[model samples]
Target: MENDREGPVPQNGSEGPVPRVGVAVFLLRGKTVLLGKRRSSLGDSTFALPGGHLEFGESFEDCAAREVKEETGLEIDKMEFLTVTNNPFLDEPKPSHYVVIFIRALLRDPQQVPQNLEPNKCDGWDWYDWNNLPNPLFWPLENMVQSGFNPFPID
Candidate 1:
């Protein structure tokens, strides 16, 4: 196997592959959702849901909480799994990944405007109605937005 930082994975366990788990959060308010642009060396410069790779031993819910905080500087509670995607575009080496949990969360007291916390992870943030999100976003994210699905149960 070559030094594949973000490569596809072999079918069997014989390959020493990388195991990565990414968690994304869809923050919603009155049908408008928050979106961000990927920065640094991961993902394209296109728009994307706010979330990132999970740290070792971190639960999907925890990762969602942490990432939302780290990237948006907004405290969120009541996270729920919206969907999971096998996203390989994050890295090149190893079998893409096992899971990418998409979480739908409610932002507590959302700031009047968007702010960037992880300068290297995202350049800026913006709010838009889920139906009117910007185009040219990461494919997976666009699918999530277009689906209009919410994993969180409603009363």
Candidate 2:
């Protein structure tokens, strides 16, 4: 096989790479939602919801619950389908694409504060007002905000 690809070899021995699915969570407490400042991985230094890549053969809800616990050390409940996003990492040296699924969840116990369980992946977790989110949100989250996706349910 004559390889003329400019970047790294595609996975699974395919000629083209496939887009991955990402799962991001929205953990709300009243008007505030939990967000973590990313420290490593794709969107380092940007704030993102507490979730990660969807595992093979796992349901979206399952991935959401698992990711939140793995990253924030807090159990979430009452999950609701939020929204979806298509993100492309064009600026990166390596080409990457992701379709992110956003899930809205509530803390199993409202009083249970979040902890940064994966210190290498996140700086810390904090609750912030939806309208007053911190600057430099992750690409998927920024896309969600731009589309006016609110975590609060319409009453």
Candidate 3:
């Protein structure tokens, strides 16, 4: 992947290879939500939602479950669509991904939610009231939470 001052470029079939993709699931509980701190070297050690890339042949919902389980070890009772933000930061050869797919997920047991992975995916895990979540939630979660937009349809 060449790094020019501009950004990334898609490779021609005769030139190189296809790009890799990733996804994110923003699981919400009541007025509170879940966020994961990046212990890995990928992001800026910033705090974000619980999610990861899509596996080959896996449905988006399945991938969402997998990521949540891998990171938080909790099973999501339900999930609803939220929003998609196209990350406009990339350079040639190395394709930058769409970043994340936000989803509002309902957890069966918010009080009993546990982190199964050791040392754990993040250094810490805590639930925050959507009205007053910490300011450092890297994405536009605060705005979304405030809007009261319910993606899940009620019968």
Candidate 4:
């Protein structure tokens, strides 16, 4: 028997292997969505939604707002929880499990623009037509697509 070091073992002294909670924000601008090119070690160079890990005792909306501001320098409102995806990245060298909370949100102001606040973590942000997304999407995003999750409202 061997223990897989998917990620740093928990320091809490529990059984270990705790799943991390990630909040994926979908900033919808009409028929388009906002995406950023990840520069982080996990999803390097892949296009992903604007979101990050859910902090201790923080509500989903709070996490969404914070991550959006931190990642894209944009404020968001009217957050509606779209769906949840369980992503297990066990095949990668640094494997881990993530319970991703997909949140569909809108810009607080229509004219507010996004900036590369964390240039080291991500490239600049861009508006993308949901139907015409760029290739090599991040794992959770790909999971959403594969599950046929649509951010748009049904007409």
Candidate 2 residue runs with Cα over 4 Å from true position:
1-11
Candidate with the greatest TM-score versus the true structure: 4
Q: Summarize candidate 3's per-residue lDDT along 1-155 as a digit string, tens digits.
A: 01011223355544533343445665666556666555543343456676666667977678777777776788886776667655533442434544456666777676656573633346555676655666555433434546674444455
TM-score of each: 0.75, 0.89, 0.68, 0.91
Instruction: Please give the lDDT score for candidate 1.
Output: 0.66
Rank candidates by lDDT, best first: 4, 2, 1, 3
Against the reference, the lDDT scores of all candidates come to 0.66, 0.77, 0.56, 0.80
> How much lDDT does candidate 4 score?
0.80
- Candidate 2: the clashing residue pairs are none
RMSD of candidate 4 to the truth, in angstroms, is 4.8
For every model shown, the clashing-pair count is: 8, 0, 5, 0
**Tens-place lDDT digits, model 4, residues 51-113:** 888878999899999989887789998999988888777776677787888888999999999
Candidate 3, superposed: residue stretches over 4 Å from native: 1-20, 91-95, 116-121, 139-155
| Residue-level lDDT tens digits of model 2 in 19-102 | 777787888899998888877556778888887777789988998888888877788899998777777776766677777788
Look at candidate 2 and tell me the lDDT of residue 20: 74
lDDT of 1 at 128: 76
* Candidate 1 clashing pairs, residues 3+ apart or interchain: 4-93, 5-93, 6-91, 6-92, 6-93, 7-92, 7-93, 9-95
* Model 1 spans with C-alpha error above 4 angstroms: 1-15, 40-42, 90-95, 111-113, 145-155
- Cα distance off (Å), candidate 4, residue 42: 1.3
